[model samples]
Target: MQRRGLLLILSSPSGAGKSTLARRLMGWDPTIRFSVSATTRAPRPGEEDGREYYFRSRAQFEAMIADQQMLEHAEVFGNLYGSPRGPVEAAMAEGRDTLFDIDWQGGQQIRNSALGRDVVSVFVLPPSIAELDRRLRGRAQDSEEVIAGRMAKSRDEISHWAEYDYVLVNDDIDRSFKQLQTILEAERMRRDRQPALTDFVRGLNREFEQR
Candidate 1:
């Protein structure tokens, strides 16, 4: 029997390189399906619906929340961001891993839901605070005041490192992504996590008795 996929949750502070890592990991592995979240925010230039996010209205977002349809959601900088429950379930049912590029609070919500056991969480970190600040400013999209606020938020995000099952310090992108890939590989093979493997173990007994 094929094993069900792991729900991989990769979280990090802003400018910690999670988005790059996620794209690289998904590109390297075909078995994983990246979970595109639903958002109530307007799309940026070049952003597409369903590719970037399922951009929704406040009413729709509120309705999803009211009906408990979202797997997890949070308000980031006054914008509503959340994961839809249906798409994740459909992907996992097909034995494909679901990648969630979200924060720790979102991870906590999923863990509290039925989907909790499917999750394997990884938290990414920057090499240093100075590097983090530099990376954020390198984007050049924000004002100095906005950049300062993000830096402050970064500290708060990093403080939750202990909540994750694994943590990776990203000094280098390629190396850190490889480390993340290795973690995914190991997680997929965990015995207790793969209940489907128990059937194979049972089959060994039949072969032994025949011998």
Candidate 2:
């Protein structure tokens, strides 16, 4: 049966392993498209335009928002970031799933947008605050002040856990990834997603009547 595409949204506080999980998911299913967001922030070293991000200027980013080209957008750490609606909708129309690795605010916006019916939102939580702190520090990419800021913001992010359709505590990467796979498989089987099922069931009923 041909199935309609879905939007799989993964949201989590920084250092909770959502980004790691997102990469793993794409590796597991190369057909899954990652929604490349447009960001106003300057590209980091080795980051390329339209690869890591769209890398737009603040004015360009705001213009996209004003023109309603963004599927969802939010300001974070003094920069604007958003998913472009065109590519995502086009992928979905061609029966390809799109994965979004965004924060809770962006997740909420997408989940409430016109395409909400096709969205499956998941929130990842850390096992403990201390562990979350440790993970941030372990990254060694941020300063003490930056890590401290993320730790504080994490509490607010965690508060929106209940807003997600699924919540996973990412204590073990392997186990969490397995659970994510299970969720994706099950959601793909949902009745509404499989439009071909209608014709299949009708044929079954006709065969039963003839028999």
Candidate 3:
């Protein structure tokens, strides 16, 4: 049956494993496309345009916003970042889901956009604050100050958990991933997502009348 694609929005605190889960979901379904965001920040070494981000000048980024070309946008740490609307809509038209790994603010904007009806948002949470801190420290990728800042921000992020369609406490990666897969599968079967089902049911009704 022909099915319309959905936008899967995953949001969580810094160490809550949303990024990890997003990667797993993509691996499980290779056809899913990741939403590449546009950013005004200069690319670091080894980062390529369109792969890591769609690098744009601040003026160009603002122009996109002015023209209503961005699905969602935000200023973070003095840099502008947003998801371009064109590519996501195109993917949806082609029956390809787009995955978004963004924070709560971005998720909120996209969920409230014109494409809101097609959005399925999930929020990931840590089992405990101590576990969250442990996971961040275990990565050893940040300085003490940076880790502290993330921990502080995590509270605010967790506060928004009730806003999501589904919430997963990511205490176990494999278990959480299974739950995510279930959510996607169930959502795919929703009557609204599969428009072709209407015609199929109509045909059945006609056959019944003929019988």
- Clashes in model 3: which pairs? none
Error of 3 at 62 (Å): 1.0
- lDDT per residue (tens digit) for residues 101-136 in model 2: 988889989988999999998999999999998888
lDDT of each: 0.89, 0.93, 0.95
Using alpha carbons, what is the TM-score of model 2? Answer: 0.93
Task: Give the winner by TM-score.
Answer: 3
Question: Could you tell which candidate, 1 or 2, scores higher by lDDT?
Answer: 2
lDDT of 1 by residue, 112-169 (tens): 8898888899999999999998899889888889998888888888888998889999
- If both were scored by TM-score, which would come out higher, candidate 1 or candidate 2? 2
Better of 2 and 3 by lDDT: 3
For residue 115, model 3's alpha carbon misses the true position, in angstroms, by 0.5
Model 1 lDDT-worst window of ten: 188-197
Worst 10 residues of 2 by lDDT: 143-152
